[model samples]
Target: MTATIIHLATPEDTVRLGQDLGLALRKGDLVLLSGDLGAGKSTLARGLIRTIADDRDYEVPSPTFTIVQSYPDLRLPISHVDLYRLSSADEVDELGLDEALMEGAVVVEWPERAEGALARPSLSVALVSDGEGRKALIDGETAALARLQRSLAIREFLAASGLAQAERRYLLGDASARGYETVAAGTEQPLILMNSPFNPGGPVLRDGKTYMQIAHLSQSVSAFVALDRLLSSRNYTVPKIHAGDLENGFLLLEHLGGDGVLDADGAPIIERYEETIRLLANIHQQAWPHEAEVGDGTMHHIHEFDRDAMMIEVELLSDWYVRRISGIELDGVQKAAYVAAWDAVINQLNGCETSLLLRDVHSPNILWRRNEVGIRRVGLIDFQDAMIGPSAYDVASLIFDARVTISPYLQDHLLGVYIHERNSAGSDFDEPDFRKALAIMAAQRNAKILGIFIRLDERDGKSYYLKHLPRIQTYFDRVVRHPALAPVREWCEKAGIFSPES
Candidate 1:
């Protein structure tokens, strides 16, 4: 229902527009290209196709003769259709466009030839010759229109960063609102463009704070940039911040290679996991500052993982996971009991040695730079939500990685590696106290994860997270049996939190 005009000064500019839009695109999208002959529609389509394929020089021949060209091997398989040769609009169905959309996106050139047969949610691009250049009049429904706007915003940000000519390639996006892209200018080293828009911490729940604010989640990219500098200064392998627009939440960061700690078969490589634990041990041994200065001379405070934050997180079990599987909303007394259960566990944390918790030290966030020496071999990312908490929290995060199934034997091996490294380096490392904290943190994290997975399924319409619930439940049962978590164990048993499927 809305329209935006993008001015393209040259054929390359048209291609750049396609590349920008390509980054915003998702599967099942339809792109209608309407333009006169020699209006560069094919050129733009080629750019978009090449970007999805992650290759700058991918071969994209015009579909004039073939009628349709399907690239099935790309990130999202896209079908480029030339409706110019179709004798009738009904022929559009014969081309299997509906089937193509089921798998990926479809781009239709000379859409007028279809005579409105292609009725779907589409981004309409009308190209017109403007002197020697071309202008694109883009219009669409809400989702498609929002995609174009986001793409244009990225273009504006890149232009301001003086990398207007950089080749933009979609890197990855997470469950959060953050997105990342790799932008390389000419033959220069590729850099990561972190697009993290400010999250207006949702409706205030208590004490005039949203869930994000109550839990100390980073509301902006300032935390990431500040933490990157802080960790890098301590000789850790966090991405070096090259440039950033803190106000707008865009950061051009060093592209730490995508070599994760997992092996080729998607299983954890014991060596890399051990090395990562050693790296974490080294990190926990050091005393970190409570606040670090951002590049803009503003202070970024690292919040303490206090009782309110912990209790709020654990309540996710009662609020989402319990209600989802059992359809039983806990009454006020039940919710109060749940809070009381975690109080004892949190109190026990008082005796544990405390340090900074990476909060998300798992397989996905960790990178194994094999060529790098010592602790630098372990590269860290996604530490923006880092908190000042028990040192054992990070160890628990690794030992019981939510994504990877770390067997009991393997978990013991990695935990032993961490304890050995910590005790060898640090003074007064009490093994019993550390073990108790690890158990408490592990149970707490797994409880939060169960509720989060269910919340993602019901609230966000993301069903994929449901598959991980069984794995997390098995891990939760193992840790909740610890003597340190008796109160939590008793509450979970009564609430039927152990039986997620039943």
Candidate 2:
């Protein structure tokens, strides 16, 4: 029963409203647009499709005659259907919208012609003439309504930041609810609108704290702003925050080019990888403050990636992966043994050198600016979950990236590059200790990733991550063989954690 009324002062406002709602659209969603002739229904639909297509000037000819027009190549393939000519609700089935929805979402104009045959829509927009403009009465399911409200909030935030006229296009979204959009204003190069909402923490599960709290995940966008400013101060290549709404969790950030460490073929670029390692070495070599004052006059405190956090993440392997993947539930005795094994491994990190770790320095978070010289070519991002942890964690994360199938030769080369850079900088780079830390961190990360990928598939219905499980498993199997993780390897083997049957 969630509903909202939006006042559109102009045709542009109507289009913008559509764009706002488009941000929330997903596959299998039904967006019903009802209105009289010349009520801007088609115009609004055009804006929505264009936004989803990430092309502002995309041509969206009216589907009035065609009955249906499908955009199959877009990120979210959608079909625009016009039911104005339907004689009865029974005719609705002839349009094949139900079949279209199986591929993606559908936007139906003149849905009133369908009577009650259409399925319950995720969103319904009723447009009415208001003076020279229009008024839209919107209502939808709770999740859809919340997403629409958040999208409108982003619009308001952009307006307050003097980017009301900017063209916003869906860039990308992560496994988390956070999303990113590319905003273009005039000719001033594209900027990133970080659409991160305050996490508010999830349900409390342990020690009267939520999983996010135990994991030390960033609950506020201010962490990103603070870290960005901190790194920028140190001459590291991070997005520059032009404006931010700390409370509302919106940030207008610099777009640090589109190139990443991966090439067009999605293979790791060797030269870029070497430069990234150099950048990481420089960052690890520096001393960082535990707290920093951001532009908003609020102090952002960086948390330590303690043993508790690492242990909780490793437990994911048992909690989700073991049950779902291995089809076996761990008894109390087995669970405790598994925990004890991880405890011993995490304890090994006690005396290891600690530094600010970005947690995920994988290919996706890295951007390459080939035009920029030296380390400046490497742009760092997605570090909101940054923590003070073993510097080797970030190195391990990159070398054993969960997203890509890194060859063993490439892996060894990258490790060699990191170690050489650390040594070349005259940092007391304990080769043996660093190698051990890297192995332990690699195993821990891969275990957590396996659990997360399974959880994402079972809980979130995001099956895309399941493809990465094999790569991560291979990586984990290799790293757990290290002597530093002997106890963990033994426990996993005894528990049939990675049996051939699994």
Candidate 3:
């Protein structure tokens, strides 16, 4: 695949672009930043670092004299290396450049010195200083670059047509999936256009007042239809679908706001956590009285937690990740122990009552609306994976997330609140039993995530998720330590699953 190139028209634009890009960077990434002395290289680097490490006091000077300056305090260790003073490729190798690249995000100033030694970069930002401002040309094979290019191109086209002003630029991309594009608006309201070959779920846009969109038919057509049905029944704050061009997968949706609930930095973490958990409870608790009569009966039952299916998923994890990439051998005893652990989890979940499960209930999937009222006020997104399953499954998924850690105290408190609320509504759910199931579900979920993360990195070449291994392992550790699953915990410990501490 070819890399996308973006034109950064101004100094502010260059810095903004850098800051945006920095949010997507993770450990074990190679970002080659090349530019002349006055090309705003350090300025862009400073902006990128500031986004990741908010303190921003670290002097982002040219690493000419030092050759390499490492910042380990940040979530990902950043090695700012200047190869301007290097004599040859051998000198680059002598500096242990490869070792540094293996561990963290490596920003090379004069990568030409070690052109042959450097691996394929996730992103290569080349900055050129215009007499008036600066232009940034970002090149890379990654999906981020592709999405960035498409978005920049779209914005430029809209600007040239006089339909979009400079102030109303918006860029959206899936950092996890590695696809992105941008949109701009004119005096009239902006329309959501679904033009990507990938992401068939259509796009969303907002005018100055409200969100507008046309719905397009795709693999996720049922999801959109369900969302529309949900809007009618509940007073939830999801984006309203204004128009639809079903054939082309286009949608005009009411724009909620420029920022999502996840973007609220000023809000207290505990407050956000409580609000999010409460919203989840609302969805799980509020059931359609005619759900069985409403549509097709393809939904999996909560009580039907299949040991065979669970074992199959667990074996796939072993085959695709552990055995394939790590080359880890699971002997007869090891295999039997893993299966037993997985079977115990399945049996535990089978006893729970079924509820509406929003499988992907992480931070990114939720949108907090300030104007909405009550616990059900949160805006939900990415519900395509919705299913009927154990209530604790989604709860476990949210609390023991691999990407971000919810505080242990808050997680426990939310569990208490969720169970209390459910019981108050005449549900016969048991708290102690639910907590045990949650621990098992968490272990199963983390195991699946570990496999998925590895597949994304090794198979798809999206290595950004590799850094999340430690966080995922932490979740596994917490789950395995549960007294109810002590047998499973001992087996995992022997297998070195939590060997690498985050």
Candidate 4:
């Protein structure tokens, strides 16, 4: 545990730092507050609670008397605990403070009273009173340390980039190892702080490399910075990189509002989805280079969606999903056939010229700007995983989204619109070949999602992904209906993996 000593010059400094930490806190996290009776432990906890509540003036009364207060009304549930009044360790146990970690993040005052009764917290902040101020000592484990380090660097970056006093607020994050926050400095427009540090994958699983390496997933934020510059220059709706630390993976990007193509019921809106595909066609019309400029005299090379990568991705269906759902394991021959089918399709796509494939082109990554005109109205995010691959791969990603259910009728219509847009641009876009590529990619993508969604549910303790299993099956069925995917269809049918009707 490394100790970080921060000198809080004033009460304002203490609250400001607390707000920054508050944005980083999430469920299954803990923060231990230790201090003397009047060393501002309650003050710091109050700052966190108020910030999360989005009510600066809300009275966060200390839980010294009640021992705990639950703010279930807030967007993120919070449980505030006070160990100051607990005379015995058994009393702390009776309060069941550990349960708070599972439900939401907990902030405890005078946690030393419990001694070894609870698990180690994500952060332990110790306050010591100075003459007129205080000094805070922070300590945590690797994950927590990484977050703290990033927050410290962000504070420094904002200072250097002239957004020093920006009010940092928590924004939504996804299953990926990435985090985002909104920073509003003065009355100026808000900026997004993308915290996507390089997280090295575990042991070498494939060809002396990790899964991330095999998948060509971005390890750092430089790919994003480079792709952002390239797409923005092409008149696309990519966020502008205002300030950044590429090596350390901290970026200050323009905030694209979160108005995605999905409606309130989480279904695809017709006009927005059509516009999104048109934007994709417009992007595919251009000739993009394999190498792109990142910063001063530095260039980044985009990876290709080669046959090996394609096979490895589809293998996820066996590695994670089938293994978990049905306990169905693949033998050597079964695995080989799966690889061969994917290899045939990926090789077929490589025959023609390729375009930059932003691997993630689903609704979650798309933003709809009503005020903007033409293709510029569609804002794209999550391009760090982009590669030079078949343009049809992105088309499949859009129409066969995992989160939003794309019916066969709607999918066909969207596909037709995409083709029309390409033909309107006066390109020799072959419809039949594109359909075959789209079919292959749909199968490839659906296989990945089937495994990925199950992995998230079974291994990661996120059960909500199980709700989309049937939807993924339906899309997977649509994939194999094409003649090019007959082998994969036969394998899946004999395996009896998907649902009957699906």
**Which residue runs of candidate 3 sit more than 4 Å off their true CA positions?**
1-170, 175-182, 185-218, 245-250, 258-268, 288-317, 320-337, 484-487, 499-502
Clashes of each: 0, 0, 19, 0
Q: Is candidate 1 or candidate 4 better by TM-score?
A: 4
Model 4 score (lDDT): 0.83
TM-scores of the candidates in the order shown: 0.92, 0.96, 0.57, 0.93
Report the lDDT of model 4 for residue 204.
88
lDDT (tens digit, per residue) of candidate 3 on 36-92:
876777777776676556543556766779998887777667888888888788776
Runs off by more than 4 Å, candidate 1: 57-61, 65-73, 90-103, 187-189, 499-502
**C-alpha lDDT score of every prediction, in listed order:** 0.88, 0.88, 0.61, 0.83
Per-residue lDDT of candidate 4, residues 1-502 (tens digit): 5698878877777787777677767787888989887788888888788778866787888798999987877756788999877888877778866777777888888888887686788999999987778999999877886777677777778888898667777776677778888888664567888988887965688689887888888888988988988888888998988888877778988878878998888888999999999988988999989998987678878988877678778888978876776676888888788777667666667576579999999988999988899988999888998999988889999999988888889999999999999899999988888888888889899999898888787777778778888888888886788888777777777777753345
Write model 2 residue lDDT over 1-502, tens digit each, in one string.
7469888888899888878878888888999999999898998999999999888789999888888999999989989999887678898888888888888999999998888899999899999988767899999888878888889888899899888867788998888868999888665679999988899787998899888899999998988988888888999889988888888889998898888888788889999988988888888998988886677778888999988789889988999999986687899999999999999888888789889999999999999987789999999989888899999999989989888878989989988888888888886879898889999999999999988888898989889899888889999989998998998888878777654224
- Runs in model 4 deviating more than 4 A are 26-28, 54-59, 72-76, 115-122, 140-143, 499-502
List candidate 2 stretches off by more than 4 Å: 1-3, 499-502
lDDT of 1 by residue, 1-502 (tens): 5478888998899999989888878878999999999888998899999999999889999899889999988888999999888899988878988889988999989999988899765698999988768899998778878777877887888888788888899888776789999999554568889999899988999998999999999999999988988998888998877778788788888877878988888899998999999988888888988998777879999999988899888999889988887888899999999889899789998867889888999998998787889889999989999999999889989989999899999999999898899789857889999999999999999989998888888887678778888889899899988898888888877887673223
Q: Using alpha carbons, what is the TM-score of model 2? A: 0.96
Residue 374 displacement (Å), model 3: 1.3
- Root-mean-square deviation of every model: 2.7, 2.0, 10.4, 2.3
Best prediction by TM-score = 2
lDDT of 2 at 225: 86
